[model samples]
Target: MKFENLIMNVGYTDTGYSGIVQVVILRMTHMSMVNYSYLVVDHINNQAVIVDPAWDMRKVEQALENTETVLSGILLTHSHLDHIHLAKPLAEKYRCPIWMSNEEIAYSGYYAPRLEGINITPWSVGQIQIEPLFTPGHTPGSMCYLIGNSLFSGDTLFAEGCGLCFDVQGAYNMFESIEHLKKRITPDTLIFPGHSYGRAPGQKFSQVLKNNIYLQFKNKNDFTAYRLRKGQNKLNFFDFQ
Candidate 1:
């Protein structure tokens, strides 16, 4: 099915991940905490993948129960608190490996300060397949996921805005990542970000290509100047990547 066609309401309760593909977007009413996370289930194999699980572990567990799919693994886009607050607990509860980029694995503690030695690196499990793309910029280890044609862009790419680039290096890296995504991912890919601020849950990769003005900046200097003008006083190097 087309990725846009799969979009659904924010509060998709009682939804199960089955069939060829299933996505349930948990409602995150709180500010800076929108869209708890996404559970992508592949019904063909009865396996599941959890992406950026943020709030209500019970809801996630229940989604798994409803779908009759195993909690195969967790994919983290970055080490941001809201994106990964529930990761360790969920991993412990399901005994599933947590996957992320090698960079995130090494420098995740800045955001997840309480976590020590949490195994965060890329490894696949179950029927859900994930191809990791190193899209640093929102943070040094920020990453995105490619599942089928859907890109689970954790703060890296948003519908109308791009991930916040706080540092010069990060901004530069983000520019590169955006360029890479444009060239590598399919135009039909749907973007599922970590937070949408109560907006719809997904956007086509093509839309971001056409509309994300941050990506339109001719150079990193231009993008950095734009961010500075926006009044971002501090660098958030460890927040997005």
Candidate 2:
């Protein structure tokens, strides 16, 4: 059950906290948007959870069949449409619950029969422990899920840059979220961001801190000014990149 030269792909083993749980992550880039849809394969029980299910179901289904795993859950990092388009259909098909931040549900009025608003910090499904870190900035309820050492940052932290901010406060909030991550996660922790943006996904956190220009500002004001500065015109932004 392997596909080469497809991912932005990463695989590793962790002698997990509750004994060894082999972690196999399959990432497929969205056809139009570059959204990194991650399928975390729990080899122990032949169960899997897809982070921000979106785009083609054919690829997802094929991955599941190849890995010989059943979709056990859907984990969302934010309420953005591009990231969440496949949640309900996949949930209905798999009969698995969906997890998203409670704040996002309140703000976006997003609802589903099986969509559960996650309030408590860390919780478990079956044998996996998922901690939803409230990393709001790109949106009010945007969150990043902490599973083992990998951070599934949806529109919050990118590999070489961060997610776009909506306003002044949001820019500041994003700064705080990034700073908070610096304190919380270790250097070796791998970051699997929602989009590739500047660098590829699945880079070590230390590399992000070192290269991400957005992460260098110590003062929130400076960060906000630079982030929200008037050069966001698509025409202008594309020139810089």
Candidate 3:
């Protein structure tokens, strides 16, 4: 089933942004789970970048073909195996660079020696400006990309939940990152999450603030207490593969 209000048109206007950028949400199922990959295209130039491409290269290729957009880069939210599995092959096929957090390269122990790596920093393609926010917690190098008014929040903040914090330190970091996001991102900012774990594929920051219980915590201690009370499973970094 598709999420409600899923955009299908090319010239759709984002909530806060005045300019129209082409964004296609490509949903791919892998290992009995749904993963959402995004194609952000600069329609004027026909240049595009794929974010968190995992499983089903055929669908990815088909999306690119249907949009008539050329892939210029591959952007990774983190180095999770599920997210990066197709990065190398897609970059190789398109002759484009793979952009990721350098910290993830060391933390996850998954290296791409062949594909050219562009350290995740604020950059742009055509008219689209991408600001990479270092929101660690889900992983040491977990990042959220703010493109225009849309936030490509890897595994950091989800619909009503947040990423799993494997340790106490990660939990603290996650809390701090969430606080920071609230300060930086506007109310109308659109959140495009990595997984299809939410009620919808995407959400407005205003709605998330109003609806997300995790974000309702007044302090870090409360957030940590809630996480601890919930008994979140401690994850092994390498086991994600």
Please report the candidate that would top lDDT against the real structure: 2
Candidate 2: which stretches are off by over 4 Å?
A: 1-31, 233-241
By lDDT, the better pick of 1 and 2 is: 2
Clashing pairs in 3: none
Score residue 227 of candidate 3 by CA lDDT: 63
For candidate 3, the lDDT comes to 0.77
The deviation in Å at residue 193 for candidate 3 is 0.4
Higher-TM-score candidate of 2 and 3: 2
Candidates 2 and 3, the one with greater lDDT: 2
Top-TM-score structure, candidate number = 2
What overall lDDT, based on C-alpha atoms, would model 1 receive against the true structure?
A: 0.69
Per-residue error for 151 in candidate 1, Å, reads 0.3
Q: 103-215 in candidate 1: lDDT tens per residue?
A: 78676653332232323243444445567888989888887887766778888987766777777888889888888888878767777887563235567677777876776
Pitting candidate 1 against candidate 2, the one with the higher TM-score is 2
Enumerate residue pairs that collide in model 2.
none
lDDT of 2 by residue, 89-203 (tens): 9999999999899999998999989998897478765556677888889998999987777788988998777888989999989999988888888888889777665555678
Residue 233, model 3, lDDT: 50
lDDT of each: 0.69, 0.77, 0.77
Residue-wise C-alpha lDDT for candidate 3, range 143-222, written one tens digit per residue: 88888778889789887678777778888889998998999898878888877553665578999999888898888888
Ranking by TM-score: 2, 3, 1
